[model samples]
Target: MQTGNLLLLLLVMIAGAYYLGHRRALILARPLGGIRHLHSLPFYFAMRSAIWSALPALLVLASWLAFENSIIRAVVVGGMAESAQPADPAAMNLVISQIQNVASGAIPASFVSQDVAQAAEQLSRLQNLSGMAMTVVVLVLAMLGSAWAWLQVSPRMRARQKVERVLQTIFMVCATLAILTTVGIVMSVLFESMQFFSKIPVTEFLFGLQWSPQTALRADQVAAQGAFGAIPLFVGTLLISAIALLVAVPVGLMSAIYLAEYAPARVRSFAKPALEVLAGVPTVVYGFFAALTVAPFIRNLGESVGLSVDSESALAAGLVMGVMIIPFVSSLADDVITAVPQALRDGSLGLGATRSETIKKVVFPAALPGIMGGILLAASRAIGETMIVVMAAGLAANLTINPLESVTTITVQIVTLLTGDQEFDSAKTLAAFALGLMLFITTLVMNMVALHIVKKYREQYD
Candidate 1:
């Protein structure tokens, strides 16, 4: 059977088991008055039976799913036998691929040999048998679990509490999975960055002011010593993000204020979603617009004012990014502002404060923490943005703060470093990981700070 079909079958079997268990539990509880005499209703007892029956089988299925591929691969490798093993890893891998193809009925006559043919036949038979055995075992275990759980149910059973605990465990497991995924990513980046740091000194990378990444692959050729100083890239990121924030914050906050405090329902219903359209525009589209349209317009405008400006400038990219972030800030801020207790605004109005005065003095302050949190989140997004800066901001990493001049960012640098032909162990490739690590840390810190502020604000309000 296909993998998807197998999975669906497993799910169906589990559901059937749950139903059986639930029915059995109701039957067992019936002599003692069943659900009527229990602390929880009959359905809760059934639900508890169903959950207990399904969970163990589900855990087994999950474990099997996670490890099946590796186990199968190892078995296949070992079954190749000593005589068929290739001396080289690459050659052995090629043989393994051919064997797998033959087993799967994908290999043509050109690749077939007697030994390989024999191995393929054996592998196919083994796989089929193993799969059938596993399926039977899973179904049997599910049935046994259902029967056991069905016997456990009684009139005195705390079914509701048991179900709640199980649900809490499931939620905790899901939360742990998310946290572990993040931790895994960070660990991978950290290890790769360490590999990079070993090749290049941390002091030189951090302190050097110039930024050039090109190096010769040939040993005889003189390679340029790459200046790994990240200051310029960071500055460019900050400069562009600052400009974006300047553009986005005022507009987003003002729009949010109008929507929350003054705008007619019809106006808000139409305008809020319309403003969100800016957020939906792809970054690549924004990149070209920044590079081709916005950059030229800004350069022309700068020239009219007798200011020399690069065609690829930080200002253009920043402006677009700011436009991109406005909806994010405004939407979140609007929700927070709306969530503020209406009593505060009513009290301020009763004191003779105008709508505008109440909003400014009472509503905005109440929602400021959440608004700041939203802005910080937006800032994190802007800092990590790659395409707009890559297209509009030139690669030359100049430390100057002139928004009209060419600039780069950490994201752009990371992209350039890792793209095309790359050796994972090389310093250049490792630099991308190091940059990723730094970027991750920066965003993590920002998020934590935003969360702290929001939590404190929530505590105050509560």
Candidate 2:
């Protein structure tokens, strides 16, 4: 049976185990007057049975699936003649792929060697047998576990304690997996970035002024060892993000304040949702809007005023990005603002303070930390944005701070560097990991700064 269908059957068995356990508990309790005499609740007994029926079967199924293919491949390869054996990892991979293709009918048997065809047949047979064995073993284990739990369901059993311990273990395992996954990502990127920095000096990458990444495919080919200056990319990212924040922060904060404080209930209900709808619109749609409408309009306006504006300027991308992130700042700020103690506002008003005065003196200070956090989130979103920048901002790695001129961000360059078929051994390709590492560091520093600010103000307010 398929793994998914087997899982469904396991779930059905678990459910049946739970029902049967619950019924048995009731039958056992009826002769003793009531469930109050039992050590734990009937629900715990049912849950314990369900857990027993599911956990062992799941573990066995997972282990089997994890090792099944490798074991099958080893067996198939071992069965082949000594001369047919692969000599290396690459050759082994090629042989395996050929066998898999033949087995899957992507390649016909008559096209391949006799040994490979025979191996494909063996592969197909082993796969079917493995599936059948897995299905039977998993089902049998589940049934045995359920039967054992059914026999163990007694008034004296500490079913609640057992169930709680099992749940705690599961939660801890999930948390550990999350931490390990994050560490794995950081280590992978860090290792690749170290390799990149080995090829390109860290000083040259960080401080140089030019930003070309094109390199020759072959050593014999005549090409410049491309400039890997990252200063232009950094400047462009900051320029656009600064512009976006300038547009987003005040407007979003003001809208949030108005919605949370001054607006009528009906107006707030309609206006807030309408404003937030901008966030739900896809980034590609925003990119199209920026490219087709905002960029052209900005260029036309600049030309009419005797100023130069590139067809794809950072200004257009920034404006549209700001619009896209408004909901982040507005929604978060509004929630924090509303969460400020109403008693504080009332006390300020009682002292003859105006509504605006109460907001400025009593509420805004209390909500400042959350507002800063919201702004930081919006800033991060703006920094990481790629689709809008790709569509609206041209990929010119110019070092100028001119918002009217075209610019590109680190994310855009990362996408550009790794878009098509490329060798990871090349500095050009490895530069993507370097760029990603820098971006990660930049974000981490931003988070630290923001946290420090939030902590300082939060402590004072608290």
Candidate 3:
């Protein structure tokens, strides 16, 4: 059955079970002089019945959806004879894609071989049969589970305990799945990075002075052994990020302080939303602003002053990125600043401190951790920005501290290397994974450090 249809059926069954359970609970309690004889309330009994009806059927539907695609593909491919089968898994996937396209009417039947046409027909029939079977199985399980729970619903039944345990189990499963997903991502990237390291020495990738990655396909080709030095990309990433933080931190923090603390209620209501609108503007739109407007303006301004500025300069990209992340810093800082106890501000003002002095001494100190967190978030956002950097800063990986020069970052290089059809064994493609690993580790370490700082210095103003 379609996932949506199965969900609808489950919901209906749960509703029906709830009504029956409520009625049954009232009937069971009536002989014993009202619901006081019941172990728990009517609501808990109904909820227990509903949970029983929904959980088993939902599990069946989820299991079916998860394995449906792979099972169908295997069955369709297995039906072909050994001589007619694909040579490799990759070719088999391609053949499967064509069959799917044909089956879905994206490709005409005459466009494929008769064998493939027959396989597509077989695939459709199996899918139909599977759907019908799944519908029957799920519905039956829902009805059976509800019936069993209904019969078991007596005055002594621990309906509250059973319902709470089910919910707790569901929550635990969700949390475990999230942790597992993160670990899985880290392990996958680590494995791919090891493959990359096998091709290129760790030292060369980490500390070497050059950044060429174009490996020649033939011995006679020019620039045969590509340089894999990543110093330039790292340097460029740091330089642009530093520029962005410089622009974002002071402005966003000051604006946040003003809006949250000093602005009148009417002004605060309108101004905060207006300022946050910058965050809502798409990054691509900011990229165009950087490329078509900011970069050219910077270049022309430099030329008029008899200075050299690349048309696509890091300064332009960084400025635009800083602008993009302003709301990150401002909104977070505003929230934290506002959360500071009003008593602290009152205490400072009672000591004859001015409003500005009270803010700097009492409010700012109390909210320091949260402000630092906001700055860290903005820094991460700046480092990870790609579209603005790609459009405003040219792709040349120059290891220069000067913001006027064109440069590229790790993210930009990763995108460049892995843009087209890639061979897993090549250094160029594997380098993307290595870059990803470094980026992940860098961000992870930064988060740990920020959390440590926050924990170490945070004060309870209350």
Best-matching candidate per TM-score: 2
* Pick by lDDT: 2 or 3, better one: 2
Residue-wise lDDT of candidate 3 within 95-173, one digit each (tens)? 8988898888899989998888888998888888999999999999999999988998999988899899999999999
Best by lDDT: 2
TM-score to native of every candidate shown: 0.86, 0.94, 0.92
Q: Roughly what TM-score does model 1 have, to 2 decimal places?
A: 0.86
- Ten-residue region with minimum lDDT total, candidate 1: 33-42
Q: What are the Cα lDDT values of the candidates? A: 0.82, 0.95, 0.91
lDDT of 2 by residue, 239-283 (tens): 999999989999999999999999999999999999989889999
- Candidate 3 residue spans exceeding 4 A from truth: 15-38, 216-223, 459-462
Q: So what's the TM-score on candidate 2? A: 0.94
